[model samples]
Target: MSADIKAWYLSKTVWGGVLAIIASIANIAGFGISGAEQAELADGITALLAAAGGIVAVAGRLVAHRKLK
Candidate 1:
């Protein structure tokens, strides 16, 4: 596969998936604070992180290809 494709996959697929899993575990385990509120907050945070990671990864790959060309 091309470097750009590889980079994109790593960012959007691997990192994003990893973050989601971690977040889910943290929420279930009650890593911080207390009550259902804390769990809901954690879920929100996790979703944001996953989204950001995906965006960054895809953008980075695109930039890399553009620069290399």
Candidate 2:
């Protein structure tokens, strides 16, 4: 993978697959997630991950003794 490319964890496909497996498990437990609901969940999770990454980046810079070149 190139440095410019985002990680697989940030991908919609990866998140959607995770949601699918979760939905399947929920189905076995008699709970349900509709298609629209799954899409919404995936979108929300993706945004949340991006925000967390941003926070980590900012915190790392704040905590670093060496200044950016």
Candidate 3:
């Protein structure tokens, strides 16, 4: 909807950091996720989100009545 819409950075590295924090919390709660498992989970989620974003973009383009300026 805005010019900056295409300018944002999407970082999997940041997601990994966040996931690490979550894993730490989970470990404290006795849920027991190791670093490898956290990384795998984060990768899976990142892929799923990327796929969903592509789908949304395609659907939006298909339904638009006006072309991009």
Among the numbered candidates, top lDDT falls to 2
**Model 2, position 28: C-alpha lDDT score:** 97
lDDT of each: 0.61, 0.92, 0.78
Candidate 1 clashes between residue pairs 3 or more apart in a chain or in different chains: none
Tens digit of lDDT per residue, candidate 1, span 1-69?
575554333344454455667767887898643345545555666677768888988889988846653
lDDT, residue 47, candidate 3: 80
lDDT of 3 by residue, 1-69 (tens): 465554222446777888889988988998988888878877887788878888999999999999988
TM-score (all chains, Cα) for each model: 0.45, 0.89, 0.75
| Cα-based lDDT at residue 21, candidate 2 | 94
- Sorting all predicted structures by TM-score, with the top scorer first, yields 2, 3, 1
- Residues 1-69, candidate 2, lDDT per residue (tens digit)? 587899887888899999999999999999999978998999999999999999999999999999988
- Give the range of the ten consecutive residues with the poorest summed lDDT in model 3: 3-12
Off by over 4 Å in 3: 1-9, 67-69
Q: In model 1, where do residues sit more than 4 Å from their true spots?
A: 1-34, 66-69
Q: Which of the two, 1 or 2, has more TM-score? A: 2
lDDT of 2 at 41: 92
